[model samples]
Target: MKILIIANSKIVFGRELKEELFQKDKNIDISLLDFASLTLFDNTNQENQTYSKEFLKYKNIPKISMFFRMLYIKKVIQEYNFDIVNIHVSRWFYLLILPTLIKQKLIITFYGSDFYRTSNLIKDIQKVIYKKADAITFTNPLTMKSFLNYYNNFKDKSYVCRFGLKTLDYIDKNRDKSKTEIKQSLGYNSKKIIITCGYNSTKAQQHTKIIESIKKLDDSLLKKIQFIFPMTYGDNLNRENIKNILKSSNLDYIVLEDFLYKDENAYIKLASDIMINILETDSFSGTMQEFLYANNVVITGSWLPYELFDKEGIKYYKIDDTKELKKTITKIVNNMKEYKRDLLVNQDIIYRLSSWKNCIESWVNVY
Candidate 1:
């Protein structure tokens, strides 16, 4: 079978999933297309194909660029004669509005925000796109339920297809290293490393709110723990503001604004004693799952759709709002041993759910 997986290059999972698919079944030919760069990548020659300069000259214009991109993608799919064309992130459905663009079995995968936060015009466009889709997949059940609430007619075609952990292999390699050893290697002292605030530099992360809450804690209590904010990506302007907040907050903190290498990220996760993810909305967060795999006590927002973790018997804390974040942190700090032990007990369950080796079959079945 021949397959084509298309997604934004910025989303790393597109490439990871492509590699895993080929590893699972060597006979099945697979190719990945970066929608933004209009680059096509394949395993055999590891070749990359991009649009001609003549066509790319008009790329600055939105409508013209999208038109040519759609035309180019249609031509490529026809030339390759791929049996299945899977488009990740349903928001890109605007690019596939024309039914004739894809003749083979077409799958549309929703990545949370795409389905939950669309304008009426995009909704109309997706409504048309959904009619042409052969199947639809969501990363979590909550997102699926949200989709079903609107488009009940596609109930049979919609399936929950979560991606496997990209960090599972790295976690295995670093599992033997004790948290203390990893912390020392990373230049951190004996202080408990609490990965505070949230995952990124987005306004949704509510970094200021978290900082404010931490400021309310007593200085003596604060001295016992070290806070690390993973502001590696997202709004650059907001990142600077968060740095200022951390500077003035008087808390012992590290603001990570630089891009983290794979090894660096793995070591950071291993060293962390707690992870706080209070993002406004999330599907299935890869970072949150990674911390759980590393046995870090994770605290998330009650508003986020993380029912799968509860169903899998994973132990993690949740707060209703930023107000509860301070209280939760205080409790975890006071009872560090208990929180760590609870998370450690569910290590095997997280590993089983996150391992791509276990997850690849479900994706295959979806195909």
Candidate 2:
């Protein structure tokens, strides 16, 4: 079957989901359609290289751009003759207003931001899209609930399908490097490494607080910990913010240079001693799942959508308590082996839950 995916961009979870689907079924032809290029201004020359202004401009653009995009989308849909058309971002729902001159099974996938932070006009557009679609896919149950609350008639078409990751069967083959060597390569030494994946945005309001907490640590404890922030998109604002924090506090750390996406990310997860998801709120964070599968100690904020821990693993910190975060770090350093053992047990459960095979199987059945 031919499936066309229309999204804001060909990056982040969109790319990951595309890769997972194609790997599972070679017979399914998958194509990505992105509207990010439609924006007139490019911020590639800015000091921080952030596209915040560009994003704002795109949102506030004259109706001409939106109409042009709808016409372009309709043209592509007609020419491709796809068996199924799935729209990934809610903003693209404007295309649904065009009459169904060519009837194809339609679906909409609701990611967190599309449901929580979008404007009322977008939500109304989504309701219309939901009415027109054959099915609706949600990344988590919380998103499904949000959609239902917004449009009561969508119950029959909505389905919850969790995101999945590609598995690594031979991850141990590259484990010969000593922790000291790995630390040296990253320009650090024997410190407890805490890694956070993805961009730094104001929407992630809790990040500044996390940095403040790190700064509050005593010199003895601070010298034993290193913070690593990796940026995936949004110019280099995330990198710059992290750099400024490190400089102001005189802390030693590493920020990775940008590289194309690859499977090596799993290895980086495995190398870290701890992973943090400090989002103000999240339906799900793929980075958190990846770290759990890698058997790393995880510290997350209290607003996590679900309880990621069972009887023996994972740690939760209150957003207001820097002291509690410091205490957790101390506990992990003093009892590393116990934490590692708990994580090893949890790894098996995480592996079964996040396998790409299972996710694709669910998707195929949904249709």
Candidate 3:
């Protein structure tokens, strides 16, 4: 079956779906969109193992680009014998009407932030799109429930899929570096490491508060720990603000200005000792899942959903007290082996729940 995936494969799940689906069924011809679908699409300008063809790009004005893109998109749909047009993020869900015009089955996948942070206009458009879509996919039940609350008519067509990463994908067989070696390569001499996703906006993640939390730690404790932040996507002011905080303190930290490829990101995610994923609200975080799989101690926001994590018996921290949080860190460090043993069990549970292997058949049926 020929399916045109109107989503960028740069997203971990998007890349996983494209690669895994093709691997499982060679006859299924899968193609991903080359340009923006409103999310970051480029994988460090690296050549995609799958097919990619460039289309309209912004040349200073967005309206002009959209006009040309509409013409090209419609022309492509007419020429290619696509049986299914799968839209990944709801940012462009309004464009689902285009595939319907050509009688192609339209499947819209709602990523959490797109559906969760909707404007009035998008909500109105979603009501219309939901009625027309042949199928819809969500990463978690929370996002799906949110969509249903707005427009529940398409209940039968909706499906829930989770995201996960394989350990082998991050581990370089050729390089085969140990955890210690990976840390050394990154110029991290200290054995202690804490990772925080600073690429998120201030709302999703408390960037300033997180930084201050680290600052609040004792200087002796701070000296022993290395703070690693992936801050490529934040604004300059936020970046400078973080830099100033890092500078004023004697703490050793690394702020990655450039975005890392998935493999590199996975490596860092694997190597970190602890991760802070304190967020205001979220459906599910692929990064948090990665950290859990890696068996790293993770600090998350108490406000976010944790029913699944609680059921899985995953060991996570959502404590707000800095002193108490530090004490917990000390406790974990003292009995690291037992905590790791528990994490192994949690990892197996999460793997069973999040693996793409379990969802492949359903994905095929969506088409």
Candidate 4:
């Protein structure tokens, strides 16, 4: 069977999935197309390497460029005649409604924002796309239900699957190091425990409000905790706003706007004592799972749909508002020993649910 996976290589999960597929079956004929660079990677060849098919980078209006890009994609699908054409992100599905794309089995996977953040017009477009899709995969049941609410006819085609955590190998490698040891090795203060605030620089992360809550903390309490905001990949304006907010406050914080290597990111999560993932919405957060695997106490927004966590018995706290974040943090700080013991129970569950070794077969079965 021939499969074509169209995804941005920058997304860690996309790269991990590509690697997992090759590892699962040596003879599997799969090609990974990085939409950003227009490069394709194939494992069927003797060299098993990537070859570039550079297209002219259009500097024109987005719509005009997008039209050409869609045409190129249509050409690729016709030329390759893949048995399955998997578009890893839902936002790009509008282009797949073209006649050539649906000839083979078409699969569209929905990440969180792509489903939640759509406008009404896009929803109408998605109605058509949903009908054309041979299969639709969602990260969690909550997201699937939300989609089914609007388009119930496609219920049979919809499936709930997760893009499992990719950082487990790195977490295993640092098993010998204590949290304090890991922090010190990474040049962090061993005395102060970490309270990570959100995962990215997106406005949905609500970094400003999180800092507002942090500002309300007692200076003495703030001194014992270091706040970390992973801003490596998102809006620059939002990153600047977060940096400015953090700079004006007396609380100790780090804004990691620069990209970090995989091992570095794993150790940071491992060193964290608490994670505040109060994003506006999410569908089975991989970051939250990674923190759970690293044994960090997680506090999430009640607005976000994470019922899967409860069903799986993954321990976590949820707040109705950002103001509640401070109180929760204070509670976790005072009762660190109890929370640590409770939160540690989540590691096994997270690993079992999220490791690619366990989850990839589901994706293969989908194909």
Top-TM-score structure, candidate number: 4
Q: Over all chains combined, what TM-score does candidate 1 have?
A: 0.87
Question: How do the residues 1-367 of candidate 2 rate in per-residue lDDT, one tens digit apiece?
Answer: 8777666552456555666677777677776666554321111211221323334445457876566556566766676687887777666445445365227888777777667777777677656566778888888777788778877777998898776765333233434556566555545455465544333334363555666666666787667667766554444575577667667775556665554234455456656777666666667666676666666777776655654443334433333453366667667766778887766565566656666656767677665
Total clashing pairs for each candidate? 0, 1, 0, 0
lDDT of each: 0.79, 0.61, 0.64, 0.80
In candidate 3, which residue ranges exceed 4 Å CA deviation?
A: 35-59, 62-71, 96-102, 167-177, 197-203, 232-249, 261-263, 320-341
Which tens-of-lDDT digit does each residue in 51-92 have in candidate 4?
A: 233245552546666665666777777777899888877764
What's the TM-score of every candidate structure?
A: 0.87, 0.79, 0.82, 0.91
Q: Give the TM-score of candidate 4.
A: 0.91
Order candidates by lDDT, high to low: 4, 1, 3, 2
Error of 4 at 58 (Å): 2.1
Q: Is candidate 3 or candidate 4 better by TM-score?
A: 4
Q: How high is the lDDT of residue 239 in model 3?
A: 77
Q: Report the lDDT of model 3 for residue 142.
A: 71
Model 2 / residue 108 / CA error / Å: 0.8
Error of 2 at 210 (Å): 1.3
What residue pairs are clashing in model 4? Answer: none
Measured on C-alpha atoms, candidate 2 has an lDDT of 0.61
Q: What's the distance in Å from true for residue 278, model 3?
A: 1.6
Question: Model 3, 59-146: lDDT tens per residue?
Answer: 2355676655555555555666678777777654345445443388888887686777778787876666666777888877877877
Select the stronger candidate by lDDT from 1 and 3: 1
